[model samples]
Target: MGTTYLTARLNGGEARYKLPGGHPLTGRSTPDLELTDDGRLADHLHGGRALLLDLTDDPELRALAAGYADRVDTLTADCPSRPELAAVLVRPDGFTAWAADVGAQALTSTAGLAEAPEKWFGVPAGAVTPG
Candidate 1:
């Protein structure tokens, strides 16, 4: 079992859990693929908050993900011959919290994109609370 699994089992920390064939990117660690635009991915993977990556250079995806900028480290990269993944919300531990793979699946994933951050990291940065 992976360290996250063992730690979660032994020390009672957060566990990634089995995803049961969701997006291939979901529930997995971020790939250490080189960034075409520059910089190493590992350098930013643990940047305090979750890291939201726009890997395919999609403008809409970047704009959509930017909404969580205050809660995540939104970044763009051109990963050559990349996987089907277009965007991903990765936790500080380097595991994926949420992901939107390319092609048709992106549609389904994007629909729930708005909910991913809040699900993993609590409310939005500027969300209003009940009086």
Candidate 2:
């Protein structure tokens, strides 16, 4: 569901949708940070250069991701299957820029998405030091 939304926004092409069919527990027993039988979700994140976070091990990170995700309704969700993993992305300013599983690929990978952050976001230029 989320990944579909992102593909449309980022790719600007027809969305690809897939439904996972199997036992309900297929994703329940899997690790949060790791991809489940549904590989598309993980693939989208990796392809987008987004960070995947497991909050169960780190409450602080979870809380932070939760807060940021809340700000952007499009970026957050309650992962019933993987409650421990709180996926997140850090903006150049050290704030949670965006948070989502497979759905956020577009926002994270889209060209000029990072223009708002003068420090970093768009094209990757060599490091700039203080004058």
Candidate 3:
């Protein structure tokens, strides 16, 4: 079994059982998700938060995600790519700090989601660099 499976088993497969509340990206490494705008794979130093956006629909959400450019390294995936989430803010440790389900109302604006990045990652525009 994989390390994650083993770890999850050890932790009772529940968020409350885990010391820090966050989930792994699963099925893909953080590097694989760090695709450039041209769709080429590239290395993304694990420093800033990663904002995963769904590119299948919702133009408004896409624009709202841009507001976090200073604090996050945004990445887009095709629709249905991640069925459970419409957007995710991943910490430098490759753990999801925050995730939003697929709903327009679930993530109305960047304001509602700003605290997670600041609390887990750092200040906006990288004012407080992640350790």
Tens-place lDDT digits, model 1, residues 1-131: 69778887785345455642366667776667677766777878655778878876777766655656777888888766676667777778777767766764454244466667767777665678678
lDDT value for model 1: 0.68
Alpha-carbon RMSD to native, per candidate: 5.0, 14.5, 7.0
Q: Point out where model 3 deviates above 4 Å.
A: 1-49, 55-70, 79-81, 104-111, 126-131
Q: Would you list the rank order by lDDT, best first?
A: 1, 3, 2
lDDT of 2 at 128: 60
Q: Which digits, one per residue and each the tens of the lDDT, describe model 3 over residues 68-124?
A: 676667656643334655565555555555555665354644424545655644565
lDDT of 2 by residue, 51-92 (tens): 334322344444433423422212233445665334544332
Q: Which parts of model 1 are misplaced by more than 4 Å? A: 1-16, 19-21, 105-111, 129-131
| Between candidates 2 and 3, the lDDT winner | 3
Model 1 alpha-carbon miss at residue 63, Å: 3.6
Q: Pick the candidate with the highest TM-score.
A: 1
Worst 10 residues of 1 by lDDT: 12-21
Which pairs clash in the backbone of model 2?
Answer: 2-103, 3-103
